[model samples]
Target: MARRQRTPRRTDDNLPSAIDRFDDAVDAAWGRVFRGHPVADRIFYLASEVGDFSVLWLLIAATQGLRSDEDADASIRFSLLILGESLLVNQGIKRLVHRPRPTPTEPRPLHVRSPMTSSFPSGHASSAMAAAHLLSKRSPRLRPAIYLLAGIVATSRVHVQVHHASDVIAGAAIGTAYARLADRCVPGALP
Candidate 1:
């Protein structure tokens, strides 16, 4: 029997570590750009607000309520399943990791008020990526839009200082995998 080879673990010196530096640079640049901009500040404030996973629940409800044609309804249902799976995987991993959020003492200038939760594998990033992947699979024509939204949402997590770059990357991977799995489990569920 042949054994499967596992990918090596990423170390701090690898390319993945560069994400942290990139995040710091982005934070610094945005901080300087948005300094004293009340509107921008308010937007960040609202962006960071966590509402007990209300967005996921709403997606599920919307899917259930959808009464469109088979293709449309299936797509909606697939999206909802992806959202739920993403949330479950993201939250479950976060609980296990229990990593700490960046401290205010950190040198970066954070635009939004800090979040009060463990910060490994950001839920927002995970959910956004899952939706993006699922949507892109279902509607190839919308790939750009879906991925663009996912990128923005993932970047927002770092902008709000609620998640580290590593967290977002991990979340993206996990969410993408979960969505793929959900799609396999429920065929024709998403157009």
Candidate 2:
């Protein structure tokens, strides 16, 4: 009988190991910084709730679209982008990464909705950042507040112990990239 030929495994494992360590360290640091504060808990919990399915963003869009014709047009366009971003992040990307969430997907004492998606990239973080970007185009005057809200929404995941720090980080980056690309590619996707 002839012996079977063996093939060497591809891709380096050290990089992924190092990344996992970094993510763990950061998540631990985050927990230490803000996990014990009552006020912070309230704020982050509120932000997390608002970030669900990008409801806050949609509300903002509706408000913006209520004014002039131009504002209304821009608002509609951006709102669609926000919804689309959620679908992509929550549905599409979640399937690919398939990373388990920091906590179980079951309802916890926090009373927040437990998401079933994998936790590699946080949909809340992604939608928040993407809406912040697209909505900024609609209302430049509110840019700072918009981005600030986005940051809060993204960090709230970690604060609530629902997602890892690295998941939020990657999600923010992906949201920004997706928004930029969609803004450029979509026909008449103007502010």
List lDDT for all candidates, in order: 0.64, 0.83
Worst 10 residues of 2 by lDDT: 103-112
Candidate 1, clashing residue pairs?
none
| Model 1 lDDT tens row, 9-60 | 8766756457667756666776677534767555554445431253633453
Residue-level lDDT of model 2, residues 10-128, one tens digit each, is: 87869878877887787678767876677887889899999997889989988988888887887788877877887887778898888877753233335567778898898888888
Worst 10-residue stretch by lDDT in candidate 1?
A: 49-58
Q: Which candidate is the best by TM-score?
A: 2
* Segments of candidate 1 deviating more than 4 angstroms: 1-67, 105-116
TM-scores of all candidate predictions against the true structure: 0.65, 0.87
Model 2 per-residue lDDT at 62: 85
